[model samples]
Target: MPRASRLAVISAATLLVAGLTACSTPAPSAQAEADGDWTPITIEHALGTTTIETKPERVATVNWANHEVPLALGVVPVGMAAANFGDDDSDGLLPWVKEKLDELDAETPVLFDETDGIDFEAVADTQPDVILAAYSGLTQEDYDTLSEIAPVVAYKETAWGTPWREMIELNSEAIGLADEGDALIAELEDEIAATAAKYPSIAGKTAMFLTHVDTADLSEVSFYTTHDTRTMFFEDLGLEFPASIAEASDSTDKFSLTQSAEQADAFGDVDIIVTYGGDDLVAALTADPLLSQMPAVASGSIVNLPGTSPLGTAANPTPLSISWVLDDYASLISQAADKAE
Candidate 1:
């Protein structure tokens, strides 16, 4: 079952070469390490500080799009978490990830199925030199278990709250490609800016992403709080968080929070709403007296993304998926923004 929090659903991919000029350059740190000289690098994170004593050759990534960091920097993981949501195909790989593998002319690596939980035995069998989960929600126990397998890079701050830039920076640096990671960040920033520029309507609009709304249960509302990467991506797309969301998020470290539907008026300031569902979900929202009274719902300023499609994963930007999904995602948001009252 798909977790209610977008943070729980993992996604990945690689960017097109034409759009990634930075990827063409050889990373200086990687080149130096290739010559048998590796400088020790220590990283501080919410879990604990991890030090990389030597260059890692067999990199493995657990949880979410951590694999995209290495794949974006021209390093394929020996193993990584299999796609659990928005896969589109039953191959356990998202489309962009599959495309990256094909572009690299390499076969699929060992995919650790994470439906139940972290498959420690499967991750151990990969024999990874390091495990990356800079954007994951790994618990202390998961971290300790994985640490026994290899050096682990967990989230820097709140779990699943690591922005795309930091995710790339931390993961790439771990693999001795810090410079390349910086380049990747610059390229993506430019990409986001350029795409956002095309949808001026979405610019400055206050937006909020609703989690999987139970159309059957209209008594409560669940949403991604500011700590979530999906909410963070709003800024990347030139969207502002409604003051209500910011205020609600200010008090909690949790990535998601629920409020009674009777209090749905709190989101009146939101100009556009994005959520994972279909037409029926939208109808349900508009039909509800409390929800329909909200400006966005009454004005039809909502983006109901199909949860099962590759496009459904667009809200949570990653190194690779941004280039692939930004245009369509922005267009949807822009259209919704135009309807804002």
Candidate 2:
């Protein structure tokens, strides 16, 4: 089934013309036919400003989940980063991605293996008109190199910190489908709200995401901060952030932080602990001299996601993966929250 990969490590628009009526709304599109020339789409991000001069017919996305935007927008990318985590059957395609491709009846595109890093060579081979990495962790050097191949759309603020809605908006705009992106975002927001409402027990409960726990060693605990999209998704699901985590995240821009397990009591405010692991990992956590004392652990309020399955990736929240695993994820969290009660 699922592969053994840690999730903590993983990392379009059309414009319609407005009618003459005052009540008519214009659909989002990057290039409104202006004087027989297309207007360039300019996006500023942490790396640099990316200006897409034309609608990209051959899209190439590097880094995690960037391709999903183009694919969800009905534009198949020429190439994209291969799935390095939660890839069941070792097919390089996550289940949702594969399902989307199958629904479109399109063949799989070239998958750039990002096991080491961005495969510049594989990306360049695609000869793409534009590159999308709106939710990526691309360094300045990586941005510069990728730009040489095509116009690169990168994360606007922090690396791997872009929310799913923004990721869709930026990536879709680069492809001249801004309006469509907005609609897609609305759809997902509604879906999330409806699904979360079904799990009332999780509402207002504080949660923390532990990143890739090492069962053999409980000396330290590493967790995602508010800056990471995974933590941000808690707000989307009606979950609150533990005040301790918020305070710890205040001084750094990093997506993750680690502290000695001896300080586990600091996280007593956390009502639920969500992390990638199995029963043994849970056993290990509960058995730990320090960690076992944390309220979540002592109360059995931890949600252990399987690291090897597509469902494990659901905590991070992606466009396609939401519908695929939202109910299960929410149910688990709600159950854990109930335990806290």
Candidate 3:
């Protein structure tokens, strides 16, 4: 049986694209080699100082959230944890990332599947100089174990709960890619801006980052506030939030909004709602009593996300998915406008 989070509403084509992006080649860069100088560097982490040896060439990453950071900085991992959600054997590499790698002609690296659990022996077998566990639910036990094999970069804070920007910056510095990370983010922002501009209808509209909650309770809902699910992925588009949501958020999280039935409807007045959740959640919405009556759904102004299983935690937090959100959601919004045309 597929995991609850495995349910999705994206098209097959999108899934294929997302999968391809996950395994795509790394950008044009010279292969990293042992530079001899091992310096202790103190880098900011979700927890605290993640002191590790400098310029680790053969790195292994457990979590996929920071996968793009290294790629963005041209530091392809010698190995990455297996794709847990997206492509089973491939690890959670999204097709967008794969495509970008292909664009750069980067080689695909070996992947470690952490689904069963992290394989300490297997990871050590990769002979990785440094290990990155950024954006993961790694326990202290796991941290201790992995550190024995190589310096581990586990969550400094809650798994994906950390800021995407900070994740990018932190991972960049950790992998010696801070400058490139900034450049990648800048380019990504430019891409978001261009795409947001292309979709004139969504501009200045209040949009609620959505997730199809389990249809059990019509009132049971969740949303992406500021610090929620990288919903700020649209900030570059200059998208605005509705007064109701803005009031509710009051500067809470950046990624998601968990609200009641009344709170779900608060997004009713949102100009265009493009939710990011699984098919299970969508199923709940379609069958939901009160949810069906919400203004956005009733008016057909809601654009259900078009990404595959990748849109869940793993997909939303990565750099490539940030762009994928715009592509997937922007197209949906544009199509909505076209249908009216």
lDDT of 2: 0.86
Name the best candidate (by lDDT).
1
lDDT of 1 by residue, 41-149 (tens): 8998899989987688889999999999999877889999999999877898888898898899888999999998887767766767789999998999788767766
Specify the highest-TM-score model's number.
1
Model 2 stretches with alpha carbons more than 4 Å out: 1-37
User: What's the lDDT of the predicted structure labeled candidate 3?
Assistant: 0.63
Candidate 1 lDDT trough over 10 residues, lowest sum: 9-18
Candidate number that wins on lDDT, 2 or 3: 2
Order of models, best lDDT first: 1, 2, 3
Error of 3 at 163 (Å): 3.2
lDDT of 3 by residue, 88-134 (tens): 33534567667767767977777666767776656665666677766
